[model samples]
Target: MFLAMRAAVEETLAATLDRLGYPTDDLGIEQPPDDIDAVLASSAAFRLAGEAGAPPPKVAAEIADAFDAADCQYIDRVDTQGPYLNFWPSEQYFEHVLETGQDDDYGALPDRETSVVVEHTSANPTGPVHVGRARNPIIGDAVANLLDYAGYDVERHYYVNDAGRQIATFTWAYETFDESELPEPERESPEYEMVRYYRKANTYLEDEADEAEIEAAEAEIQSIMQGLEAGDEAAYERVSEVVDTVLDGMYATLKRLPATFDEFVKETRFMRDGSTDDVIERLKETEYAVYDEDAWQLDLPDIDKNLVFVRGDGTSLYTTRDLAHHEWKFDNFDEAVTVLGEDHELQARQLKSALEILGNDTDRLQTVHYSWVTLPEGGMSTREGTGVDLDDLLDEAIARAREEVEDRLDDRIRDDDLTEDDIDRIAHQVGIGAVRYDIVSKQPTKGITFEWERALDFEAQSAPYVQYVHARASGILAEATDGEGINADQAVTELDSRALDTPSERELLRQIARFPAVIETAADDLHPHAVATYTREFAEAFNAFYRECPVLDAPADKQGARLALVVAARQTIGNALDVLGIEAPDSM
Candidate 1:
């Protein structure tokens, strides 16, 4: 309803401005400040004050006087306070919000008819995903979900880094190291099992082995890389097997985070299929390309350093291969969003600059650079073999969540009998939801420390808090009519906007009305945290209404309207959680 009202307000305000003999290009409609006590406001008068040859307050008064609130869709009246034009919603607006909230597709936007590829969490297939880099997958998946909800056809992708030196080192370790020297598997998973080879190789090179052994190890790794790039089919097949084994383990952990990819594009494919060579050849002809220090480099615009695409040995760098990968993405999808760590910002800019120099449209590609996720101990490094594994973090989350669930079970036993299976399922949902929400709820540019206390706080601003509100509303609805619950559709039909008169009820109605607009803004800005913020606000509004407004014990005519409000709040909260890829359980 907010989206519809905003559009109507814009159109109506533009007409009013045109009548006042001022430009109507940007009316500067904005949300009113807290002290203004208005649903929407505009500061266009300030922008047009010079042209109108009058003060902003006078111009605002003139526009408000000319505005026809009765004709607008949801706006009831407009007032000029100081230099601002504040607009309030009509009773008809509340009626529409209550009726629409009961629908299953409450916050979904109209299809935009664009297809997008979201490439994220392309962590090296060397070990299980760790908490340090977990932000990539969580943010990437949530962004995809937002796009999908925004009506874009989105395909999630993981660009497998199989052609890098890391792969060569992992392969070398698996094939060269003695089986007797490898440690026993910790978790009986392929990722856990295969990473030992890489870790052992790293430990030997960095700490244990002598200089001669290190030289031999590095030489063998160099040979494997050369062979892979030189199109040695046997070497390619062998390394591919190791990569697939590790990926199996990685996928197991990703599934627990509930992140899935529609495509697993191998970087080696670009090398084998001549796409990498094609990229190098194109860069060689560009004006920015220069042969310096026995390597081909492109002097990027506005940057002091040149981007190296080819090394002294003639092996193309990862950036060059990434160019080929992006070209593939551009060919197949209308747009692509790549998620990367803050450390990769330079590489991303270089890629775009090189793409521009190649005469390709670089606007089709977008990059979201996020800071690292740290622990109380410090940062993590897969190479150094230090960091909390994603599996371990999730395992501990579930165990801790189980204790919370057990305590809640004892309190609610008289109302609902939960079996052991129910307890376990609820534990997983809350645990995973806490982790996902904790990471995705923060601004992508900021780093976060994963804490169970904050994430699982039932009374605080967390996923469990939001989920518990959902369960509370469910309990209220279920207790009505002897467990049959009020028929939400029927209640919506009989909903009376006049009966929803209390301040708390009005606030909740306002929050429910803003759901569609919140999603649209988040989708446009590529910010998933916006929806998370909205969900928290919506939950708070519902809690206030629960405290002040009676649902089942309301006056006879007000009962159905209050029940309908509950239904809408429950559905909107659930839908918001779904957009974040977090489950909204019916019970706590």
Candidate 2:
């Protein structure tokens, strides 16, 4: 929706400069700062100020004059600010900004339409998902959605490490321990049972009661894993049972969280299909890999750590499976994205270098390490069964959201109006939104200390606030729908501005019109937080407008026009939410 306007603006600027005898190619511009009230701003003329051998203010004034002389019909006024120039939209231009985007192709970009694969939330299937693991999918799903929205043929994937020792231990511990297996739920966390068993396994190992017994258990697990890797029919089926069982419950919790993957790749598949060996050979043949002491290692070119890809026994490590995985992705997608936590920075970076080592075009694959902030409380370790379990976190978020809503609305909403269905819907929206938006509201590189007050604040840029704005827009439209809704081609007046006469109204229009640009920026940077931040900007603008501009109580013709404006604003915001894989319920 914004592509056309951007092109038109740039083209008009270029044409205006060319007609005025300035070199258009050398001149560049950017959208004005959001904090400012200007329509457009740039310092292009600043570059030529010294060449013109005149004062910067004089140069800026001349360029501004030249731009104003151009026949572009959308701009209201142009002003010079020393070396910078600014453009302000006329009220008519504000109306045009709404109607202007009707035919705009905002979503699709030139980089889209080719299939891209993103592997995210590929948690060790030993236990439930954790808060750290949640970051990957929260970001990955948004990335995939952005790519798709931007017109890329995209696929979301989860690489299951079903053959890993972690799974073997988890399965081993589960089968060996019966009713007594569950650990003491001292603190009663979400993963109380799982954590209990994990601690039990460690405790058993630490006791050193019987070396033979412990060795026997290890051998049994290895045999099972080896069988699955070697395509043993029974072993594969057995492993699948465990995977299916955990995945069923895991996916259930994830569904509530609302992130999904289209494909689930198994690490064992590499072993069964012999691709893992092929990748190992390719790495060894090239000078990219070397036999280091006993293990197979990537050279890493001295810029980073030499990565261990395989053990001396030829057992595949995470890096080995990843090498094979990248080969698969390169053959399958035009782009591949890896959203992982910060702890694996070295390993993930080495994985990319390993791909470059194994004869794949480094340019063909774009690997992004979307590192997330870890809770300062602790980190999750399989052996210790520690960290924040995602299932538990989500449950807590929902419970908190429910309590918050029910706490306030209990008196107003009677037994007849407030039902399970309504509560669930609201809780889910706010709970999930709170989680997603919490991280998304900040740059991913920045750490977040989870705070309940911030997460559930309905007045903050948190989920509830934005969702409330969406609901408010709907309520206004509901009252107007009795006889109002502008026809498809209804004409709007220059004076109407849709009751957009206040500072807030102007701000709202600017924000509504800026949605496409914001989305494009977010997509380009692979940053969903940009979109999140924009949602708050838009919501704040809507609130301010709501507070000052009387949409429903304005002149009837003007009120109807303003309703149309609100509809467009709501639509644009909804679309933004959709791009983030969020739902803006019509009634919130």
Candidate 3:
């Protein structure tokens, strides 16, 4: 509904500009300031004034005067504030929102023909997922959800880094360690066990292992890599088993966030299928390709760095394999999005450069490089065993959530209405939601210092707060119908827009109406924080309306209208939470 109004405003502005003989090609419309009580605002008059040699305020006034109310039925007034033209929505518009906002696809965009692939959480399979590295998957999943809500056909992908030296080191470690003496797999996940041995192996190679042992390990890893490249069945099977075991633990962790990948693309596939070789051959034909120190390199003077595509021993580098993978992505989808940590910024840029050199469209690939997630103590390192495992973090979150829920539901718990299972389920949802929301609610480029108190806060801008608001709205509606039911469509049909006269009521309606616009903006900007912010604001608006106005206790004529508003708030908030990949329980 908001998007429709925005479009109507844009169209009216464009028509007014055309009538005034001003160019409307580059005119942009945005929301007015919060204090302005306007739906849409535009400073296009400022630019147009410069183009037409007129004062900006005068031009803005002229544009406002030229706006035809009939052309934009939703916009009741257009006024000038300095050089800005702001538009206010009519009561008819609010009524339109209350009527249509309860639809299942209320905030969804029109389905598009474009296909997008979102590849993320491609962590090395040698270690368990750590809290420090959790940002990528959370952000990536939210991006995919946002795009899906925006009507893009999105595929969530996990690029398995199975061909790398990490895997080889893991394999060597597993072989060298006596399984009987290693940490019990039941105590920690298999991935955690593998991580311990892998770190042990690294320490041995660096500080304790003899030169011959080091050489022997290196030779064995090379042999494994060769077998992998050659598609030897036994080698492939062995590596697959190890990677699959680690992935089992990783997937278990991700399931807590309720995130799932549509596909898993192995890096080894590129090497085994000759795509890596094709990339190397194509690079050799490019002017950027050079041979230095017996290695194939791409000398990019523009970036003042040289990226090696192949080592001195004729083995392909990670970048070479990644180029092939990106090419494959482009060929299969209209657009590809890769989510990585800030540390991979250079590699991402280098990947684009390599794609450009290969004569592929670099614009097809979008890389979102997020900053690190750290503990309050400091940074984390997987190899040093200083990183907090994702499983452990989730367990802590759930434990905290259980305490909060139990405290809040003390009466119900004592009455035997809220079972232990119920508490557990709600705790899991709230806990995972808290962690995911905390990470994705921040801008991608900013680092987050995860805190249990902040993350699990039930009163702050966390998921639990929003979920509680949703539950509160549900409670109001449930009471209105005496726990029977109030059909949202039927309730809306009885709505009288005149009853929505209070400031808080109008503000709630406006916020509920903004859901579609927020989704669109988030998808376009690749920022899930927009949705997160909107959900909080919507909840605030609803709470204000609830406090200032009576729903069931209102007069007969106003009761239906307020009930409709409550239903709208509930549906819109639920939808917003869904887009953020957070569940909105009807009862908290």
Candidate 4:
């Protein structure tokens, strides 16, 4: 609906420019300033004035006079202010919004029939998932949700780094631990046990180990890598066991955020299927491929760096495997969206460049590189055993949410028939929602210092506040039985737009009307944080409308109109929360 209105306004401006004998090629429109009493504003007149050698204000007036409101269905008036022409929406636009806002598909766009592969959270399965790496899954999942809402066919994936040295190190640590000294896997998760020894192994190699011991470990890891690369049954079984154990714990952590993947692509699969060797041969045929010493490298003079494709030891680098993986992605989907860390920015670029060198269109691959996340104490390292475990973080969030929920529901606990289990369920939702929203609400390229107080603050810009507003709107609709003959659904279908003329009501309607535009923008920019920001603004507008407008106490016509607005606000907020992967509860 917003897009339709903008199109109508633009058409009017273009027609006016054509009628005035001015070029319409560079004409554009933008949102007016808050002080301006208009829905759509444009400064095209200023540019047109310069082009036509006329005064800016005089050109603006001429364009305003030339605009025909009768030609535009949604815009009613066009007025000139200084060097701008402002367009206001007609009553028909508000009526259209009111009539269509009750449906679940209110803000959705037509399906574009494009398939997108979103790959993210491919963390090395070396330890339990940590807080430092938690943002990837949240942001990635939110992007997938937004794309899905925007009518794209999105396939979420996790590219497992199961063939890397990290996995070999994890396996070696698990195998080298003294059996009697190791914790029982039955009592503790295998990943948890492996992480303890993994840290010990790294520390031993770094500090206390002698050169002989270091060489032994390195040789063991290399042998394991070679065996896996050769598709040895024993090597595959042993490595798969360790990778599966770690992934079990990782998937459990991911489930807490409710993030799931449609597929899990193994890096070793490319090695076994000969895609890696094929890519190496292809690169070798290109002028960019150079034989440096005993290794094959891609000499990128543009970046003044040479990327090694094959080591002198005959092993392929991570980039080689990534190139093959992306080749598979491009073959399967129309587009591939990768969410990786800022540290991998150069690797992502190299992957695209290598693909381009191989005669493939690299533009199909979109990479979103997010910055690091840290706690208030400082940075975290998994190998040092210094990061907050995801399980521990969730436990703390749920515990804090339990306290808040109990306190909020203390007075009505009995009246609402609430039990301990109910409190637990609500707390789980609130806790996870808070964590997900706090992590995903910030711009992905910016670093965030995760703070407990800020994340769980109910009055602040958190998920709980938005969820509560949704619940509040729900409560109002549920109690809207004023003994009148008017039905809520019927009222929505028969809504009267003039009854919503109050400042708060119109403002709320305007916010609700912007939902589809927000979703489209987020999907186009690959920025899920925009949806989070929009939901908060929508919630604020709803709250203001609720406080200032009398709903059930108003006259029959006004009550029906306000009720329709309530229903629209509730539905829109719920949709926004869904896109953000947060729960919108009916009650707190």
Tell me each candidate's TM-score: 0.96, 0.89, 0.96, 0.95
lDDT for 146 (candidate 4): 90
- Tens-place lDDT per residue, model 3, 526-565, is 9999999998888788879978998767776687888888
Clashes of 1: 0
Order the candidates by TM-score, highest first.
1, 3, 4, 2
Per-residue C-alpha lDDT of model 2 across residues 354-418, encoded as one tens digit per residue: 88777678676654555554665766654566667776677788889888877767555637556
Looking at model 1, the pairs that clash are: none
* lDDT tens digits, residue span 34-92, model 4: 67657778889778887779888899998888888999988889898899888888888
Candidate 3 is scored at a TM of: 0.96
Off by over 4 Å in 2: 16-26, 68-70, 90-93, 100-111, 174-200, 370-382, 410-420, 483-499, 585-588
Error (Å) of candidate 2 at residue 338 is 1.3
lDDT score, candidate 2: 0.71
Q: Which structure is stronger by TM-score: 1 or 2?
A: 1
Whole-model alpha-carbon lDDT for candidate 4: 0.85
Please state the error at residue 371 of candidate 1 in Å. Answer: 0.8
Select the stronger candidate by lDDT from 1 and 3: 1
